[model samples]
Target: MSAPTIVAADLPAPADPLAQVAIARAAFASGRTRPVAWRLRQLEGITRLVEEREAEIAAALSADLGRSAVEAWLADIASTKGEAEYARKRLRWWMRPRPQPLPLNQLPATAWIKYEPLGTVLIIGPWNYPVYLTLGPLVAAVAAGNAAVIKPSEITPATSALLARLIPEYLDPEAVTVVEGDGAVTQQLLAQGFDHVLFTGGTEIGRKILEGAAPTLTPVTLELGGKSPVVITADADLDIAARRIAWVKLMNSGQTCIAPDYVLVERSVRDAFVSKVVDTIRAFRQEEGTNGLRIVNERQFDRLASYLDATSGEVATGGVVDRDRLTITPAVVVDPDPDEPLMTDEIFGPILPVLTVDSVDDAIAFVNARPKPLAAYYFTKSRAVRKSLLDEISSGGVVVNHVAMHCLVPQLPFGGVGESGTGAYHGKWGFEALSHRKSVLSKPFAPDPQFVYPPYSATALKIMRKLF
Candidate 1:
């Protein structure tokens, strides 16, 4: 089936930047984003909207990237649905006022943490996993009770169009709206005075988003990508390590922000490890209905093709490019020079690089040299190695025996740190990001005697000493 067409004329059309802010502010001022019942309704609306439009969603995905329907369901739509359900079920518990204690000296007063919405929120989503990226933050915003304007990636036109058409039909424009355009529209939205802006994309764009938001002193949460590393220690299970890393690295055609960029295998088991990776990539071929990898669009296809360099590495397996399908066969590159273009940027495709090293310590050092990644993975039976990796390295998160599974746990905070980007979200963290944790303190109306007041005579000091 051919992809659906979204003519420039077909959309709600881009509104003036000022108008977007004006509408969002008005809705926010109305206090629509703060009610728990209202938030649950929005969540329910999103779920029904996505389910009712499943066919269009699948077709648009297939047309845009040739992704199989099953893959779309598993990789994209399911997560959004799950997040919506999770938030709706738990919002009451999450929105409950938290209690705090005053010291014995101040027992007469009471204090508790209050959560309040942070007016208008701006959400900028990435092309890879467009559906999940778009809706994930929206769920958080709705739960936190904030008006949001979501800008989907222009690179994936079909998904972007489907979202723009369907979202407003199910949601109130004043509370939740979809805005579309190129980088220009993105810049325009970022220029506004949003209470909070949550962006999920590449680090390069993450930086630009920061630059735009900085002037307003607006708080921003950046979910950026980096060279997420995986380490295989001497004592690790070779086959299990290979299969786990291979599967995650190829999921979404390696477009995941935290997919393993390269492997640092212990020299003693290096040969066996490479064999296992090769075996695992081959296993997917025999498995029925495997959406092994997908090439999202032409620009990315061209970008992946242009990255190969003869002097950089040795291709150990399939490296052919199927231009018609925009599919590149999974390939393993070994001993790639540290300075190769592959190492320089986030490789958002099905290419895995393996570098052998003497010790886990060496691998840790190599990863530390790069900017702090969004995630780091280590495979080992030894508790010492795992502890060292956890304590010594800095990342948004760490996985002990797998890659990219940190996103599954609803309790853990998800977001990059340092250059990979800063600010965290997911579960309670997400709610907090879209809301304010306002602190308050109260005292008795009755005036109390000040033991150390300016009547600092010797007799007054003796009485104050007893109070202390």
Candidate 2:
């Protein structure tokens, strides 16, 4: 599908998208970015940018997504800073060649895998957590020693413009360029044949991105979203589960890709858990004055509103919607019809649906019946139950007794599965994702056998087969 055209009026589209790619490509060719020192410097620059410009980034986030300063810092600034710092500390070790064990047939040779840059790459940022998602991949790209072109989403114009302005000032200008435009601009950049492209957005957009990159055969890493289900086992801690679920659900007004899209609670504890979750939402909103969760735009606002309208489920609390402000109050719907849009579609809003299942089997069946989600969250105390869910459910990642904490740790890879996303990137995973692992083998010319090189005589063939 051709992605809908979105022109950013405030931020002018790049005059030449290919030129942006060309500049990065030229920069990559210069070999300046290849050095370990340069990689470390860029990582340091990212850390410094997030540190010194905390207020600016928060302000931009507020203007773009109505995010509070604390939420802004926690979600975008702090997370990104951590990722860059994590990479900076471990990049030299990551870049070192890893020796590969050779088979007995190749005993006289030595082989190793060398990590190298994939030249110029493209990082297409999403609007929700604009700064972090965009720059997080850049962290990986630069750490892998590749020049990159960052395409920040036009949906969040303020943050997009801010990124376009600030990125060059902090990092190497030629090696990294920010192109601000819409889907058309993204398509244009894809056509330029990047060495690799990492896109974070919806699965539909991901398909379009893949299509756009097809002609050039550009390798892509798609961080797309699906309905990540939160399974609450009967043996779980309801209070902690409620708090954790409400916390991530309210973040960025539930626009997060890995936020609990829906809940599947064992019937026995459904009421208690639902009540606690609703209460937690009330308490959280009261504390932060976030009764009305902000939606990015009218399209998203209307989409979320429709889910609330179509749901056959009973509303537990907070069903308020203000079209004027584009805000939908935090809501909990109990047992919506499985076929309903609220249950089926990815609810990228503050309105969460809580469904009750008789047993863990029912919950597993419900989740597995659908496309694999980016994340599957299970709140359980029992090791057996945790193991069951972990083994039976197929998702990109899983969190036990928590929601979305896996994303914060750079040790674990973050990405989606099936419709959710393609590849993962965090600390070392990100480094490896944007890098090429070239196999290097060395052998002495004196030991090279003629049987391995020539038209085979029967005796030579038998010898070659025995010692290939």
Candidate 3:
């Protein structure tokens, strides 16, 4: 069905950032959002928002980032719908109180943990995949029965504006709010000190969010970006490995936080793998019927173009850029200098660097020396090799024979280690992260014993030591 056009007059004017947060806090205090039925209603509202506004969301994404309709549906719409559906189906199970095993001394008591809301939560989203990142955390917040204030990235104004318009229409306007503005506005919101904050963006910005939340002692979940790496073994399927890597690298023009930043291929298969990767890129580009991939904006385009200009390695394929259109053809750099920007910094673009390593041991050592990535990918047929890599390397998550599939799996926790990110949130993990597990213990007053009281005699003390 054709989606209706979003008119600027129809969208509510950008709310006063502080006032928006205040509204959410007030809504949370009203106790209206805590019931299981209310949580389900909000979850269902999110599903309706996505279902009824698919075309609008796609149009907003295209206006903001030049994203294709199919790409928008896959990355932002379907993924978000999946998260809400999963949470809606499992929230009842997630909310059930878990019984705890009591110690011998507490025999007459029963204990269990009950999940409760964390009050108002603030979700600061990034330009890339703005809707999914913003609403994905909101799913957790609402499922945990907390009011939410969503802060969409200013860089993607079209998507942000659309969200501001749509969220209030579909969700409970009092319980969930969308605040739109630049970083300073974010700072103002942080100062208000929400119960919890989740920010998804670059590492440098993540540090600022941490600092901003520090004064308030507000906990934060930072979904920051880093140089996520991929390792290809000698026995790996080059055909499958190349196709997967190339496909993910081209996603969102490689602006994804979990996109394989660089490749460490075994020396024996380096040349063949590089060849296949180049072929795969060419084939995919032809299939998509695009000469160059669109970058979000000029700053990102300039950063990516500069990396291409400065790289010392051979460009195996695709070194073209169209400045007028703000797009860059995919480029594969082979064995660039390790100290260059292409190797040192997180290349959030359609640039792939394939580095040759002596063995899987060398690949492990190489990844270990760098900051732990948000994800690490390995393509190997050997069980022992996969097990060894799994044991030796530490990342937010790892995928064998694939790339970035972990994010789509609702059962697994998705996050980073060290610099890549701080906390995990997806499915139940997300529900738990956004919840406060309160421990409750019930005991009968009639069971109280005289020896348990303070002023005990020698006989009572002896009995307490044996039977209390």
Ranking by TM-score: 3, 2, 1
Taking the tens digit of each residue's C-alpha lDDT, what string does model 1 give over 187-265? Answer: 8888886899999999888889999999888899999989898899989998889989988887777878989988999
How high is each candidate's TM-score? 0.91, 0.95, 0.95
Colliding residue pairs in candidate 3: none
lDDT of 2 by residue, 1-468 (tens): 211222234433446877777777888999999999888878888888888899999999999999999998899999999999999889989999999999988878899999999999999999999999998999999999999999999999999999987777678878888998999999988988889999999988999999999999999999999999999989999999999999999899999999999999999999999899999998887865755888999999999999998889999998789999999889999999999998778988998899999999999999999999999999998999889999999999999989999999999999988999999999999999999999999987777668776687999988877876
> How much does candidate 1 score in TM-score?
0.91
- Candidate number that wins on TM-score, 1 or 3: 3
Residue 347's lDDT within candidate 2 is 87
All-Cα superposition RMSD per candidate: 4.6, 5.3, 3.0
The ten-residue window of minimal lDDT in model 2 covers 1-10
